[model samples]
Target: MNYRTHIVSDLSEIGQAGWDGLVRAQDKPNPFLSYAFLHALHESGSAAPQTGWQPQYLVLFDGEELAAALPLYVKDHSYGEYVFDWAWADAYQRHGLDYYPKLLSAIPFTPVSGPRLMARDAHARAALVDVLVATQQATEVSSTHLLFPPEEQARQLKEAGFLLRSGVQFHWLNGGYANFEEFLATLEQKKRKNIRAERRKVAQAGVTLRRVRGREATHADWVLFNRCYRNTYRAHHSTPYLNLDFFERIGRDMPDNILLVIAEREGRPIAASLVIHDETTLYGRYWGELEHVPCLHFEAAYYQPLEFCIEQKIAVFEGGAQGEHKMARGFLPTRTWSAHWLAHPSFADAVERFLERESGGIDDYLDELNERTPFRK
Candidate 1:
């Protein structure tokens, strides 16, 4: 039981083989769980201290064999985390307490649920939590939060003394569909027609979409994707978190998980959506269009992904976070959990109370979502 803990201050310090080994054994396989994915975030400057996401990765070793690791960050602000804690921070501000410099265990900007704590065995997983709990106490940070953790890991963290928080995300699951039409068959007839109309608009607009995987994605592809990606943010007057180099790097290093659907008209790439997949599921990450075509977003983002999942026989497709628009496309409401540890006793009590009320609201919201599903009776 001799073990030592190493603080991974930089991405280079964490090796992919050692990290991936632990992750492969997990109950759920989320592409975001890969070390390469998180490393890309730091290496590409998307999740660095300069960007307010200081990596404080924790690694455990039992006499030279890497046992477990957590992709932890000492966050100054919660900008990209899908789990909203702005109000929590504001409450602490009102009470004259600092909430910055909190610890987070997550896949940086991605909100897809997967393993947060990686371990070779159950013992290692439990030990990892112990180490994290100790780190939280010793650092005297405001709190430590693990966002979008898989269900088993969430339960394990709860057993290790972290407060459980719940949220909902819309995900499309494959129901043994032979094709996209079979998938639509489960949906209400009106919803089916709506999806068909959306897909038809792209073809009517003379836009044909093509999907390019990893190494197959070229410089021109990156340029087109970034242009579309940035335009989407710019239209909203915000900047993108990822850079062109990051996309290029991931395309080179991790091609199996990267899928880019590009809509082309007159031999020019117009709208593009980026998706990542593993053995189990496809994650619809980002997309934007240079030219606004009617229902083009739905075709490029939702319909294309749904078709791919059905064709590939992938188990699920997570459409990122917070999209009621996804319901009409057959993406159902699924619960996501995060664990929080607060340092201040008074603030902790206050947050716990607030969470109790928020949880009720979330439950009611999920019920409404289910009731509004476009699925046939």
Candidate 2:
């Protein structure tokens, strides 16, 4: 089969249907990988050249039909990426090498792991890998990295000679739970009691949570959610990667997949959490509060989403990125993977060695976390 590669600077060229069709064909289609989500990031200027996330999407076609694609970027820095490669960048700088403009295949500001190399078949997937490596070689970029891919895709990338890196994220899995209470029942008494106490604290503060589905959400609701989203970045002394336009776009384009958990005190919305989900999994992505309320974060971010997941029969709830605190609420440590290829041979070898050591430590960490599971034996 003859394959052709195309570097698309704008996603509009591929169109939503063509892009989302490939995504839907995946075994586990994530909302973040949907065309609406990625296009929102690009069109809203959230992930654009000005923001250091210049789109360099890779598309592979077999004759006239699209076979595989990757949501790639030419990154100027590593701020939004959760994989943490600042040290690698520093080492490059120390050696008078450039790390900026590295190729990254990832969903901007979304750390949830899913499929990265979207393909129709295994052969196309392997061909896409070849195209990715070839593109990196042809470009002046220092490296190419695929972040938060599924374990199966990560393995394929490793077989293609990409270095593998391991990281951990917390995810809550449904065990045929009939309801939130049933889920809690599976947890140890102490942990269940702690969760109950936390929920009670939010209630005692008179903060009632109201879940607004994206279709039901209004312009005012988007305004409030964006405010809270910005406040989260402000609290961290960092600028937000997303803007109001991005949120509004996604809300309009993919309403059914979006969930806005709003916390109201005295009938005024004070806190909100934005969650995105497909049929199988709910992803807790962003959360913030305008007013300080005890345990409000936990209620808005974890419990509400967990309850929704149980009600919707969603199989998994990924708590997003790092947070040992999620464990108390029944989230277990799950391994996440990324694949890397360095243009420089020495740097590539060094990163491979570092990943080996990091992988060992990650294994030990997962073991330690498993020993402290909140669920009852």
Scored by CA lDDT, what does every candidate get?
Answer: 0.87, 0.91
Each model's TM-score? 0.97, 0.98
Score candidate 2 by TM-score against the native.
0.98
Name model 2 segments beyond 4 Å from true: none
Candidate 1 error regions (>4 Å): none
Question: What is the C-alpha lDDT profile of model 1 across 1-377, one tens digit per residue?
Answer: 75699999885665777777777887786777776777788888988999999988999999878898888999899989999899989988997989998999988878988778888888888888899988999996899999998878888888877888999999998998998888888999999998888888779889998878776899999988999999989988987899887888788788988889999999888899999998779998989889888988888888888888888889989898998888988999999999998988887887888889988999999999988988999
Q: Count the backbone clashes (under 3 Å) in each candidate.
A: 0, 0
What is the model-wide C-alpha lDDT for candidate 1? 0.87
For candidate 2, the clash count comes to: 0
Among the numbered candidates, top TM-score falls to: 2
